[model samples]
Target: MSIAPKPNPALAELAVLEGEWVIELSNAKFLPGSNSRAQGRVSAEWLDNSALVMRQWQWRRQGDLDHRA
Candidate 1:
């Protein structure tokens, strides 16, 4: 079996951002005739005993770009 690596000192410093966040887009008109608006969420967490940090994002509405990394 594989083992989890030790936590990195540098990764510990990023703990402050370990949580969920809401995203918003306004007046970022990708189209015409009106101001466009959208919303989504972003989440960050430690992986493998803080050996790495993983972040994922998703946007509201449609058109691809809807998955975890």
Candidate 2:
């Protein structure tokens, strides 16, 4: 029989962000035009209960799609 290893406390601490979140950006110069607004959804979760990974998708007001790992 095989036994699973205990989870690391530091890694477990990331559980606080294990949910869907709404992100909004306003008055950002990163956009093509000035004074832009963007919104998206961020999903965070643990990978195999060991590491935390976040995936984000955003749509800019200028019809642009952005993703982050």
Candidate 3:
């Protein structure tokens, strides 16, 4: 697959994460303990001058674990 190019400076600067991010998970904890922990990734790309698209993926683990996206 062809990879997407990088965004411009103006678009990059404008793409701040100013809003609140609400994440939901299934039987996962934000921290590691007796409960299983989930690792996630956040990626951003410019859709236009005024907006951007963000994506997130979640995976479960106790320690160093492979992530699937």
Among these predicted structures, which one has the highest TM-score? Answer: 2
RMSD of 2: 3.1
Pairs with steric clashes in candidate 2 = none
Residue clash pairs of candidate 1: none
Where does candidate 2 have its weakest 10-residue lDDT segment?
55-64
Off by over 4 Å in 1: 1-4, 26-35, 61-69
How far in Å is the alpha carbon of 42 misplaced in model 1?
1.4
What is each predicted model's overall lDDT from 0 to 1? Answer: 0.68, 0.71, 0.54
**What's the lDDT of the predicted structure labeled candidate 3?**
0.54
Model 1 agreement with the true structure over 1-69: per-residue lDDT tens digits: 987688888777788778888877676656232555566888878787664354788776444355444
In order of appearance, the predictions have TM-scores of: 0.51, 0.62, 0.34
Q: Model 1 — which ten-residue stretch has the worst lDDT?
A: 60-69
Ranking by TM-score: 2, 1, 3
Pick by lDDT: which candidate is best? 2
